[model samples]
Target: MKRIVITGTSRGIGFEMVQLFAQQDCEILALSRNPKPVQELNLSNVTALPFDLASTKDLENVESFLKENWSSVDILINNAGKLVNKPFTEITAEELFSVYQTNAVGTFQLTQKVVPMMKSDGHVVSISTMGGVQGSLKFPGLSAYSSSKAAIITLTELLAEEYKESGPSFNVLALGAVKTEMLAEAFPGYEPPTTAREMASYIANFAQTGAQFYNGKLLQVSNSTP
Candidate 1:
């Protein structure tokens, strides 16, 4: 069985991914801020780790735990993120920092810690946003959110290059506007968007074959695949 580790598994895309992978008979090590209900999923191979991503120090503990338990991870999915809808001028420095803390720094740190623990031919999927792509608009007050995600995209590209000869491969998925609570919170009056289940399936399929097509490329959900 393939061993995988994913972050932000409490809700939205993260939750759906945990469910989908469990069905595929993969062993999952999922992380989230909340501890409750993850146990309710009742998958024998599922382990939900509760911790705040903002705490960079927590990554050390996470790494220690993984080292003590699992031998190596076949897949590492960086799915945790944070978004704020304040206008560029209205958003405080702290708010902007918060966005980067979870979306970029947390991902960077977690990925850094996991790279050495990955098995040969392993894969890493960084969940990004279409908003990160060039020409992707910044409606009203999404400057911080867009910028942070953009940073993640660049980080993904850099990883692809830095680890080219390494055993594992890296890719970034620039997801289109998905119908998750994050979308609802960002655009409250907007109509329903893509379902988490569909996105989850897409991500699962991508995890399986995406590295073959995109090593450093950005795979936009709407245009890259169906």
Candidate 2:
């Protein structure tokens, strides 16, 4: 069975993706700050662990799990994200740093820890917001969240270049208007067309096969009209 690691698995897309992957013939490591949701699922091949992208201790927890239970990881889904909605002046350094800590630095560290355990054919799929895409439509009150996510886009390209010959590809998906808790928090009263389960279905498939055809690329996933 393929060994997979997915972050942000407590709820929303991450949680739904866990359910989707659990149906497949693979072992899943579901990481979230609140691991109880996933643990309750009690899937035979899924292990739920309390994880915080901003915490060094949580990173070590995942590493320890990998070193003990699995020989290699076939997929690493960087799906966890932190969002802060506020005016530029209202946003504090601490808020910005916290965003970057989870969305960028923590992701970088975790990927570094997992890459060595992955085969050349493994895949790293990072989730980003459409707002993070350069030249894309900008939104209000997401300065910290959007910019932090942008970092992963560039990081994905860099990692793909560095590991082109070694195998295991890196790519990012910049999503738009998904009906998620984070979306509601960022844009109140806005109704997104895409549902969490819908997005998870697509991401679940891509995480498994996208590496074969793509690497070091960013795919903007959106269906918003006008």
Candidate 3:
């Protein structure tokens, strides 16, 4: 069975991804700030790990876990993220840093630790937002969140190139609006065309197959056809 590591598995798309992977017989290290939800699933293949992407201390724990328990990872999904909805001018430095810490900095830190543990043909997938892409949709209140996700896109691209010869493939999934709590918080009263389950299913399938054909690419997944 494939060994998979995924972040933000407490809820939303992350939670759904864990379920899908577990159903497919993968051994999953599911990380979340609160692991109770994952633990409650009680699946033998799912190992719920408590983690807070914003916390460097928690990152240390993640590194330690990988070193002690696993020699190699087949798939790594950097799916945890933070969102801040505020006007550009009103966005505080702390708010921007918080979003960046979770979406970019923390993701990079965790990936660096896991990269060495990844198999030669391993796949690394990062979850970014469609708004992060240049010339994509622009929203008034997503300045910090969008910019942070943009950083993830750039990071993934650079890592893919840097590690091209070394082995593991890197890719970014630039997802459109999904009916997640994060989306509801950012766009109150608006219904998203896509649901978290739909996105998670796509991501789980892509995680298993996309690495064969895609690397260093930003894949845009949306409800509407481009």
For each candidate in turn, give its C-alpha RMSD to the true structure in angstroms.
2.2, 1.0, 1.5
The most accurate candidate by TM-score is 2
lDDT of 2 at 215: 98
* Ranking of all predicted structures according to lDDT, beginning with the best and ending with the worst: 2, 3, 1
Give all TM-scores, in the order shown. 0.94, 0.98, 0.96
Runs off by more than 4 Å, candidate 3: 224-226
Per-residue lDDT over 1-226 for candidate 1, one digit per residue giving the tens place of the 0 to 100 score: 8888888888888899998999999999889887465668888989987767787667877898889998988899999888898767899989989999999988998998888988658889999887788886547677888788899888988988988887578888888777788988888866555788889888987887777766877877864221
Better of 2 and 3 by lDDT: 2
**Preferred candidate (lDDT higher): 1 or 3:** 3
lDDT of 2 at 121: 92
- What is the number of backbone collisions in each predicted candidate, taken in the order shown? 0, 1, 0
lDDT of 2 by residue, 1-226 (tens): 8889999999999999999998996899999999999999989899999998888888898899999999999999999999999998999989989999999999999999999999999999999999999999998788899999999999999999999999789999999999999998998889989999999999999998898899999999999821
Better candidate number, 1 or 2, judged by TM-score: 2
- lDDT-best of 1 and 2: 2
Lowest summed lDDT window (length 10), candidate 1: 217-226
TM-score of 3: 0.96
What is residue 224's positional error in candidate 1, in angstroms? 13
Q: Give the best candidate by lDDT.
A: 2
Candidate 2 residue 222 C-alpha distance from true site, Å: 0.3
